[model samples]
Target: MKVLLASPRGFCAGVNMAIDSLEIALKAFGPPLYVYHEIVHNKYVVTHFREKGVEFVDHLEEVPHGATLLFSAHGVSPEVREAARERNLTAIDATCPLVTKVHLEAIKYARQGYTIFLIGHEGHDEVVGTMGEAPEAIVLVETPEDVAGLTVADETKLAYLTQTTLSVDDANRIISRLKERFPQIASPPKDDICYATQNRQEAVALLCSEANLVLVLGSQNSSNSQRLAELARERGVAAHLIDGAGDIEAQWLDGVETVLVTAGASAPEVVVEECLDFLRDHYGAEVEVRTTREEHVSFPLPKELRAVSVE
Candidate 1:
């Protein structure tokens, strides 16, 4: 069996920064470091951190006063930040810069008296956070169908923004529908889909052509990872979205000779390695990495973490 691995897979710059921030915080503050959510969506990553005494909380009130709270890379609503402040918590934002870009666009369009249409899943952490920026003026659209029924008080004064980790093809289809319906609708100067997501999906689409089955390594709740699997399946290829090797089933590999392996931006590399190792042991697979694009993006640690300590 041959394994075709996709390039630009696994952790993205934002996930790297968020994970690194947690490690740095742990080093500086010791055990019992609290995180607002799973620093990223990967269960392995969160479980690893939990073993190191990192506490993950869903509600700000669950966090004690005066505790150091780190926001997840998925970003949070302004209300969440305010709640942190209300509890006297020292908050560190690990939200990805790409996600922050969407928030800024929502605010900008809302400030300009334009009703904003946010293209994203309704309940996603990133979508929720971006919508919170201008809740009064923003409307959530999950699919192209949603765009068709969309109505605004001022059609000419409408704008659209998108979540960073959405399916590129789906987002474009939705955007095209929006444009067709409202010829005067405005969009961001640049697309909101992040480079990491675009490149990874493009790579998987390319890899699926030659592979009999595509194994996407990502958490079930991970948007980008789920999109990768969906993209492959859309091409009539057999695809599976597994968190790690343990989830892989022997029956799924029957008649499958070439397998394409890829991971989500928030997924850890170790999970990919484990999956590859499992295939190699079970099927004596030979591996090859198919390059679609090279990535060099890097985000700096939080400013608070960089401050020099007083002697």
Candidate 2:
């Protein structure tokens, strides 16, 4: 078997910032630190942090008053921020700047009395956070079919924004439908899908062309990770989304000739390495590293934590 490892895969800039912020926080504030959600959507990352004494919580009620709390990379709505403030919790926002851009756009559209359409999956942490920005003005639009039934008070006063981690092709398809239905719908200066998401997907699509099987390393709840596997299956290639190498089934390798391995933005490269080791020891897989694109993007830690010494 031959292994094709993907480039521009795993731990994008936003994930880097979020993870680093937590590490710095841990050093300065110590364990028992509370995070609003899973720091990033990787089971290993969350479990690693959990074992280190970081407490991941879903609600403000789960955190004690005045405790230091860091928001997840998937940005939070003003309401969540306000609630944190109400409890006097020292909140350090680790929201990706790209996601923050969408929230700001939502606020701007809502303030302008424009009905906003957000293209994202329902119940996703980022979607939920973005929706909380202007629940009254923002309507969640999941599919092109959903666009058909959408009603607006005034089509003239309409705008559309998207979740940063959405599949690029999917978002484009939905946007096309929105434009056809509401010609006047305003769009952001640039598409909201983050560079890392688009780059990883592009890499996967390129490598998927030659591989008999594609393996995506990511947690189930990860939006970007799910899209990678779905994109492969959509391309007529067999793919599986697994948290790590342990999830790989022996039957999956039955007739596989070439395999493509990649990781989601939140996944760590160590997990990717472990997977490669497994493939080599068991199948004697020959490995080739390929690059579809080069990524140099980076993000700085939250300002409040700058003073907190980071190792």
Candidate 3:
């Protein structure tokens, strides 16, 4: 067996920043730290943090008063921020800059009296966070079918923003439908999908062209990771989205020759290496890294934690 690894596979800049911020905060502020959500949507990462004394909560009410809290990379709604303030929690935002850009755009469009149509999964952390920016003015649409059934007062005064991690081709198809229905609808100055998401998908698509089977390493809840597997399926190749090597089934590899290995932005590189090692040990697989793009992006730690001293 031969393994073809996708370039730009694991740990995008935003994920790196978010995870690093937590590690730094833990060192600086000490344990009992609270996070608004899974910092990057990977169970492995979350489990590691949990073992290290990090607390992940879905609601602000679960957090204790006057404690230090960190927002996830997926971002949070204004309501969440207000709730944190009400609880007197010292909060630090670890939202990716790209996701923050979309929130700002939503706020801007809402201020301009545009009814915003946000394209994203209904319950995704990022979608929920973005919707919180202007909940009264934003309507969520998850598919082209959703676009067809959408009802707005004035189509001309409409604008669209998308979740950062979405299927590239699927998003394009929905956008096309929206354009046909509302020609005057406005879009973001650039597509809201971030560079990391695009590059990972592109790398997987490139892998699909040659590999018979593709393996995407990420948590089930990871949007970009799911999109990689879906993209391969859309291209008529077999693909599986797995959290780690433990999730891989030997039956799926039967008759499979060239396997494409990739990871989501939030997945740690160790997971990829472990999966590779598993494949090699079991199947005598030869490995090669495929390069589609080179990424050099980084984000700084939150201001409040920058000067905090570690014990």
Candidate 4:
């Protein structure tokens, strides 16, 4: 069996920064560090941090008063920030810059009286946070079909923003439909889908063309990871999204001589290594890494973490 690994997979700049921030926070603050949500949507990452005394909470009220609270990479709304402040919590914002950009755009469009159309899944953490930015102004649309049912106060004052983790092709299709309906709709200065998401999806699409089955190493709730699997399946290739090698089923390998292995942006390379090792040990698979693009993007650690001196 041959295993083709997708390059530009696994951790992106945002995930790297968020993970680093948490580690730095833990090192500086010690045990009982509280994170607003999973720093990144990988089971292994959350589990590792939890073992190291990190507590992931869905609500700000869950955190102890005056405790250090780190926001997840999926940026939170202003209301969350206010809640942290209300409790006197030492809040560290670990939101990915790209997601923050979308939030800012949502706020801007709302202030300008534009009815914002947020292109994303309804319950995604990122989408939830973004929608909270301007709840009254932003409307969630999941697909191109959802675009038709949208009710905006004024067609001329329509603007669109997207979840960073959405499929590039899917977003483009939705954007095309939005344009067809509202020709004068405003858009962000650049595409809202982050470069990392676009790069990883493009790599997976390319890898799927040569491989019969694609194994995506990512948590089920991970939006980008789910998109990767969907993209491959849409291309008529068998794709499975697994958290790690343990989730891999023997049945998935049947009649599959060449398997493409890739990971979501939030997934760590360590998880991917485990999957590769399993494939090597079980199937004697020869691995080849296929590179689609070179990425050197990096975001700096949060200011509070940077202020801490190394011991």
Candidate 5:
């Protein structure tokens, strides 16, 4: 068996910074650390943190007053931050800078009296948080069809922003539709989809040409990971999004000579290694790496964790 591993596949700069922030917080704040959402939407990363005493809560009421709460990389709305403050919780922001960029854009457009159309999956943590930024000013559009049915008080004053982890092709399709319906639709100065997402998708698409099946290493809920699998299937290749090596079924390997492996932006590299190990041990797979491009972006730790010395 042959395995093609994708470079620049897992743990983008934002995920690394978020994970490192939590690690520093865990050391500085001691036990019982509380996180607003799954740190990065990866099952392995969240489960690992949970084992290390990080409490993942969906609601602020579940967190104790005066506790230290870390926001997930998905980024929280101003409302969530205010609730954390109301409870006297020491909140540390771990939201990805890219996601934060979209939030800022939403705030910008809303402040200017423009109706913002957010291109993202409905109910996604990032989308939910972003919409909360300007609830009354922003409208969620999941598909181009949603764009067709859009009702706006002012089409002349319209703008669009997208979730950071959205599929590039999907976002572009939606953006194109938005443009067709409303040529005056304004866009963010830069693309909203994070660089890591585009890179991983492009890398996987390249690998798909040589593989009989593609294995995406990420949790079921991971948006970018799902895109990796979706990208492959769109190209008529078999693909699966598995949380880790254990989730891989033997039937998936049947009649498969080559497997392309890639991880989502939030996925941990250790899980990718584990999946590789599984394929190597079971099928004696030979590995080859496909590099799309090198990424050097990094974000500074939250102010609260900057002074903490983590071993």
Candidate 6:
């Protein structure tokens, strides 16, 4: 068997920044640090943090009063911020700058009397966060068909913003449908899908062209990871989303001569290496590294933690 590895796979700039922020917080404040959600959508990453005394919570109410809180890279709604303030928690905004950009756009459109159509899955953390920015004015749409059924208060005054982690092709198709229905609608000045998401999806597409099976390393809840697997399937290639090497089944390798290995934006490269090691030890797979794009993007640490000491 042969293993083809996708380039630009694993942790993106935003995930790196978020994780570093948490680690810094843990060092500075010590145990019982509260995170609004998983620092990133990768199970392995979350588990590692949990073992290091980080506490992940879905609601702010779970956090004790006046404790330090860190928002996830997926970002949070204004309501979450208000809740943090009400609880008197020392909050740090670890939200990805790209996700923050979408929220600002939603707020801008809402303030101008436009009904915003948010294109993303219903319950994704990023979508939930963006929608929370202007829930009264934003409607969620998952598919092109959903766009057709949209009943807006004013068609002439409509705008759309998308979740940062979405399938580029799918978002475009849905955007096209919205354009057909409401030609006057406005959209973000540029595509909202993050650079890392776009790069990884494009890399998967490249892998699909030559491999029989594509394995995406990420948690199931990871939107970008799920999109990578779905993109391979859409291209008629078999794909699986696994948390790590343990999730790989021997049956999956049967009669499979070539496999494409890739990871989501939040996944660590170490996990991908473990998967690669498994394929090499069991299947005697010959590995080849493939590069579709070169990424040099980097985001600075959160402001509040800049001066925080880290051991």
Question: Which 10-residue window in model 5 sums to the lowest lDDT?
Answer: 302-311
lDDT value, candidate 2, whole model: 0.94
Best by lDDT: 2
Clashing pairs in 3: none
lDDT by residue (1-311, candidate 6, tens digit) is: 99999998999999999999999999899989999989999899999999999999998889999999999999999899999999999999999999999999999999999999999999889999999988899999999999878887778999999989999999999999999999999989988999999999999987787998999999999999999999999999999999999999888888999999999998999999999999999889899999999999999899898878433
lDDT of residue 274 for candidate 1: 97
TM-score of 6: 0.98
TM-scores, all candidates, are 0.98, 0.98, 0.97, 0.98, 0.98, 0.98
lDDT of 3 at 131: 96
* Candidate 3 lDDT over residue span 160-238, tens digit each: 9999999889889999999999999999999899899999999988779798899999999999999999999999999
For residues 1-311, what per-residue lDDT tens digits would candidate 5 score against the true structure? 99989887999989999999999999888879999978988888888988999999999999999999999999999999999999999999988889999999999999999999999998899999999999999999998778878989888999999988888888889999999999999999998899999999999877799999999998889999999999999999999999889999999999899999999998888999999999999999999998888988888998788878433
By summed lDDT, the worst window of 10 consecutive residues in model 4 runs over 302-311
The residue-level lDDT of candidate 1 at 194 comes to 93
Q: Residue by residue across 1-311, what tens digits does model 1's lDDT show?
A: 99998998999999999998898888888878899878999999989999999999998878889999999999999999999999999888889998888888888898999999899998898998998898999999999988768878999899999999999999999999999999999989888999999999999877799999999999889999999999999999999999899999999999999999999998999999999999999999999988989999999878877662221
Clashing pairs in 1: none
Show where candidate 6 strays beyond 4 Å: 309-311
Per-residue CA lDDT of model 2 for 1-311, tens digit only, reads 99999998999999999999998898888979999989999999999999989999999999999999999999888899999999999999999989999999999999999999999999999999999989999999999899999999899999999998899999999999999999999999888999999999999988899999999999999999999999999999999999889999999999899999999999999999999999999999999999999999998788888777543
Alpha-carbon local distance difference test for all models: 0.91, 0.94, 0.93, 0.93, 0.91, 0.93
Clashing pairs in 4: none
